[model samples]
Target: MLNRIETYYDAVPRSSARAEEFGPLTLFVQEGQGWPYYARPALGHEGDVPVAAVEKVRARQRELGVPEAFEWVAETTPGLRAAVEATGLTVHEHPLMVLEGEPLPVPEPEGFTVRLVGADDAALDTAVAAPFAAFDAPVAPGTSARVADRITAGLTRLAAALDATGSAHAAGQHQPVGTVTEVVGVGTVPAARRQGLGLAVTAALVADARAHGTELVFLTASDADVARLYGRLGFRTIATALIAEA
Candidate 1:
């Protein structure tokens, strides 16, 4: 699974329109959107990173007009975190998790119904707002349109939990969560917490992924408590991730 995750990480940059190769490292520049989309170092294989690799990465980020950030999976390339930190970049750690199991039923809590949503403007708005509200971050301009494009491209599957009045209460998505299907963006409104809406939306997407022939699923937990919540659905930590930024 670790090997597969490494391969997935390597392929992400290649999927972008603006990807440049630097030996084992790939730089993904998504017009300065942010981490994951911004300029970052992702290893294609385990090997000694050239002493000048860090300089080259920063140079490319400059050329692309994005901040120099390196998201490295330590399990994929041992010692990579230390190498990145040596370049004076701050590093943050996160749990890398994966799920593999037969489909498990997720009972929808009363007053909520989970279903797949299309790329319509209203649906997209609700889906995008859920995450922003949950994270306490202001919604960036053009986020909805960008996500709508991805959805139109058939690269994303969104699921939402609606109440009796058909109002969105919780939402999530399953897009190629990295080479493997992953449940991401699971969020519930403050008024909807402790009602199993998160589980409902997540399980709905998991079932959708399975129906589409995806076997292995993966996701990253924001913290240990969130990891424990996902554990209830059979996800387990398979590795750790390091996000280094200048």
Candidate 2:
């Protein structure tokens, strides 16, 4: 079972990258999206390029008209940070936490029941898409429809992939009150908030995890409310990550 949830920083770039070159280092670029991510050793290894190389990547991103945000691991060297700073980047800090205790046995709520979802289930898609709606950003042109389609498509693909790999799990029967996938991302809907529904969903996921021999539950927390919620469910902060956005 996965221990810590590998973060958005580690995978987002890689996920976005359509083409990559790897040698003693890795350079990943999402040409259409204008996102560029490069990585190399910190100890001045021969294959590793200087901090200027990263700045060059950022420059390429700028030239591509991408939003000027750079996401990277905190383990990046001070030299790299200084170079990025000189080029005008601001750092944003956040912590990642993992739940360590045995999974809580999910109990049925009044008027609701928890159960696993089938491979064809659509509630999982709706469950994951609801959070994006919570963000009040004006829907970009075509984004309102596209986001839902994207979420649905992504969740469908994810469900199929997990089913093939035996990684999918479902809870909250019929209407699917809750769910948890093998991959790191999990959430309850906006309509499901405050009624302890989030906890109920999470507990359902945890129960499935425990039955599957998972030793830990890992998740990243951004909001203090979610952080406190996770804490109440036995999650503890594991590490802090600093992101530099230009």
Q: Estimate each model's TM-score.
A: 0.86, 0.58
* Candidate 2, 163-188: lDDT as tens digits: 22332222221111113332233444
Clashing pairs in 1: none
Q: Candidate 1: global Cα-lDDT?
A: 0.73
* Candidate with best TM-score: 1
Q: What is the C-alpha lDDT of each candidate?
A: 0.73, 0.45
Residues 146-174, model 1: lDDT tens digits: 67777787677888888776677788888
Model 1 vs truth, CA RMSD: 2.7
Compared with the true structure, model 2 gives a TM-score of 0.58
Candidate 2 clashes between residue pairs 3 or more apart in a chain or in different chains: 114-172, 115-171, 115-172, 116-170, 117-170
User: CA lDDT of 242 in candidate 2?
Assistant: 51
Model 1 scores worst on lDDT over the 10 consecutive residues at 31-40
Q: Using alpha carbons, what is the TM-score of model 1?
A: 0.86
